[model samples]
Target: MDIHHLITKLREKGHKITPQRLAICELVLSSKDHPTADQIYKKLKQKFPTISLATVYQTLHLLKDLGLLLELGFPDCSARFDPNISPHIHIICLKCGKIEDYETENLKEQWAKIVKDIGVEPIIQRLDLYIYCDKCKKNQ
Candidate 1:
């Protein structure tokens, strides 16, 4: 992801893209790994030694509030961050703790049908499918 484009988008959205925020945005947007606030902070701190952990936490919340990031929940205590806002599913590797995003357009249709049949509105805030990935399973 181009950091300049991200900065431009944030500015266009009326978000003040501070230097620290820009760094955080660059880190989160460019990452394929669904990292936590602490993980982001630790990596970012290497480049920007002055940045604080509290700032990282605040930036995470700000990006989430702006709909540029998603908070993924799991049985594990920490929340994970995802940059993709499009409807998708996450497959969590139980052993390695890796989160991979998958897009299945048909799943939405199936969900819609299920909701219609059940006569209930679906609160599809996020979807996470937990499984032991092949590598993890093989290691066992």
Candidate 2:
């Protein structure tokens, strides 16, 4: 979602639109590179020096709760946020901590079919493939 639409949604939900909140929204949504909460805090700190990391975490959680984004979290890893909430696999670079989305629209359709065939409902859906991304592979 674009910043305007996200901000409007927040407003409709009675959320206060502070400059900091706006910055966070724009930063997260506009980012193609999935960013961890710490990464966001550091980038934002460059401009909003007083902004707390807790605030970034809270905003990220709020976005996730509202289905505006998806969180890619793993044991012993900082959670990375992806605004492209469509069905896809996250290719994580183990060495550099980079994340790239691998679109799987057809996979979603096939998955739905399989679920229906089995007569089961899914409670959660996420796909992540951890690997040394090309650059990391080259380094290795």
Candidate 3:
């Protein structure tokens, strides 16, 4: 996503476009991995020495509330942020803690069928799968 798009979104939502918030959004957008707040803070701190972890958390939560990001939670792990807000699946490596996003037409079809059969409009949905990564499997 373009930085300009995010800036426009903040403007539309009547949010102040602070430099720190912009940096957080840019980091999330550019990151390939779903990053936790600490990871984001660590990266941003290198450039923004005064950035606080609390500020990062607040910004992330605000972005999520605005429907611009997805927050992923795992047992025994800090919640991670995803810039792709659309529905998708997450595959997590149980050993190395690696996470990747997956998509399939079958899942979408099944989701539609389930929602239709239940006769209830859904607000949100998520699917997560955990497995050992290739390197972990090889080691095992």
Candidate 4:
């Protein structure tokens, strides 16, 4: 979702509109890196010197509750948030912790078949493929 839509939703929910909150929303929604809350706090703290990590966490959680992003959790690592909530695959680099999105029509078709065969209703669908990125592979 874009900044304007986000702001409107916040307003509808009776949330206060703050510049810091706007910055946090822009920072998270503008990138595809799927940064963790700590990463976002560290980066924004540079711009808004007085910004607190708690603020970043709160904003992120608020957006999450609004269903505007997807949160991916990894073992022994900080959870990464993705603004692109479409059904797709997340390729994570085991070596560098890089996250990339991948989507294929074949996979979508297969998933539909699986659901039809099982005859079970589903709410959330996600697939994460863990692998090393080309740069990380070269380094290794």
For model 1 the local lDDT of residue 100 reads 92
Candidate 2 per-residue lDDT over residues 1-140, each given as its tens digit: 67788888988988888898789888998898998888899999989999999999888888888888888777876678888876677787778988887786698888778879999876556877889878888888
Instruction: Write the number of the candidate with greater lDDT, choosing between 1 and 3.
Output: 3
How well is each residue in 62-120 modelled by candidate 1, as lDDT tens digits? 77876778887667677888888766788888888899988777977776676689897
In candidate 1, which residue ranges exceed 4 Å CA deviation?
A: 1-16, 112-124
Overlapping backbone residue pairs in candidate 3 total 0
Which 10 consecutive positions of candidate 4 have the poorest summed lDDT?
121-130
Q: How well does candidate 3 match the true structure, expressed as C-alpha RMSD?
A: 1.7
Choose 2 or 3, whichever is better by TM-score. 3
Q: Which candidate, 2 or 4, has the higher TM-score?
A: 4
Q: How does each model score on lDDT?
A: 0.81, 0.84, 0.86, 0.87
For model 1 the local lDDT of residue 105 reads 78
Clashing pairs in 1: none
Candidates' RMSD to native: 3.0, 1.9, 1.7, 1.9
TM-score of each: 0.79, 0.87, 0.88, 0.88
Deviation in angstroms for 120 in model 2? 4.4
* Rank list by lDDT: 4, 3, 2, 1
Error at 18, model 3, angstroms:
1.5
- Candidate 2 stretches with Cα past 4 Å from truth are 120-123
